[model samples]
Target: MTQTPPEDAPTDAQSTFSGTREVDPRYALDEASLGVWLTANVEGYAGPLTVRQFKGGQSNPTYELSTPGRTYVLRRKPPGTLLPSAHAVDREFTVISALHAQGYPVAKPWALCTDDGVIGSMFYVMDKVEGRVLWDLKLPGMAPAERRAVYNAQVDTLAALHRFDPAAIGLGDYGKPGNYFERQVGRWTKQYRASEIDPIPAMDRLIDFLPATLPPEGPTRIVHGDFRLDNMILAPDQAQVRAVLDWELSTLGDPLADFSYLLIAWAIPGSLRNGLAGADLKALGIPSVEEVVARYSEKTGAPAPSNLDWLFAYNLFRLAAICQGIAGRVRDGTAASPQAKSMAAQVPALAEGAWSFAKKAGA
Candidate 1:
């Protein structure tokens, strides 16, 4: 159920590379139909409409809708045949709708339309959020202390999500109950094979090795499959996360997987395009990886996972598979971004990096 983003933003990373591009013809909307539909269903809808696609979000095609009165954001599944369970606009709508209902920091969901005839695909509309979506891991433009607050806010938000009970929020059945990593490994493995271009030995090794050495499943909370700086929407003038955007990969699963996924930035070398692996943590005023984990543990009152190495390698491998799927979409001409090929090229390096971690863990 994965489709990679078009640009080079982190796979699970949602915030990045601001500004919109001309919508690809393949995913363009029927504006007349969309306007008519909105006029009838959405409250306070206004006349002539214009649409431009957001540059980020790989799996779902997101657009900004402008009318005379206000602006709205539309997220839709891309056109053409999709990988199994990929581009799930419905699931995204479900999770976001529930979260919004509870006054969570999500873009307020307006409506979801499943009839493809309206826009040629299932889509949902939400209030357009005006905020800074920081793309850089280094968090340029911010003072060191501000960078620290940004990271701390991110950590606190993640812990808060983990501490909430899914059942209490009406998401108990959001995903399968047990064996999240097992199911995810098998799922990503299938997704990778579906989009496989050329065989990478490291990917092959991870597919074979991860299952045999799965870590113990911790608590099953609402896991944001992709929870990193870019995936979040920060306040326009502050370091706090205004809204947690992109629910395409979110589901009920091990919260540690979500937390550890954020920590992967520390392991990735600064030589890599979109990671903080080898950056100067103290100079940047960003918390060290250890600090991130410790803060999450302290906030949630749960110690960091004992087998973090396994979780880190697993999350990296999953991200690599996600990138490979984007490559496949590019080859098929169904990709949403022009940067798909360059992003796909990073797959081999990502897989190799994951394998290095696995080797360290003796998996």
Candidate 2:
């Protein structure tokens, strides 16, 4: 969602996260050492590399590597202590490498560097995708029809991913199958507690409520845990997705949980992660939640999900925990993006929203 910023306006998400910035001093790496490693490890490698960091608040620090012939993107574990099982750049590379081989829309992974000496942490490099990474949900300058098409493409892409057989793709053991909600509740609860900066009462309520009222588990499939518009790169002149980025949370899980996470945009307001709650969907050409779900069901040959309220509640609670983790990072002085503080501020509101949905689910 990179767009040129108006000279007089304050920075918005589109401007703030649209392009690359000078590497943050905290996440800086030795360019000479990285270049040498790339030359040795990457196929058809070239030197005279230039590096810059992407502006998004990716838990894994991502850098753009440019050379005379081509550009590559590198994702690495952030320096300093990280939460257990977090920032798995190797997993990201593994998943993307598998998906790319299947002709899925993901950047082609080139090489993974496990040696911490090269970059202060493990990192992986992939082809730099050239496309638009949209941030604003309303899609300010896009025509109404184009907006509808883009949303359809997103739904279709996700359904395709969900339809893939993990075992066939060499990822059957990527994560435990079945009991997806139960395991996720436990996992995120532990993560939330580990990263708790302040006691959020709503979060506490959810931590207790979600586990007790877990939804029925569906068939296991590849779940892009953070699937959303902002995470995808759209073709420069078309509405189609070119590549889906950010795989830190992806695993074999309930497809419905992954799909419901995208539906969160319709429940939350536009100010939060560019949601569509209060927007005029007809005027904007955005699909309603029902339409989105129906399309997904049609594509995957699965029934539309039931117990959505509980699912939304769980997703929102999980999101709050994630934000709280960022708050912990801020407290630890290892936050990657300048926007981490503001994202941390959203935890309370997210928790509150989760509780509201819990109430709807008869919690």
Top lDDT model? 2
In angstroms, the error of model 2 at 100 is: 0.5
Model 1 RMSD, rounded to 1 decimal: 2.7
- In candidate 1, stretches whose alpha carbon ends up further than 4 angstroms from where it belongs are 1-16
Q: Residues 230-327, candidate 1, lDDT per residue (tens digit)? A: 77888877877778888888899989888888888787766543568778889999999788888999999998778877787898899899998888
Question: Candidate 1: lDDT over CA atoms?
Answer: 0.83
- Candidate 1 minimal-lDDT segment of 10 residues: 1-10
Candidate 1 to truth, TM: 0.95
- TM-score of the candidate numbered 2? 0.96
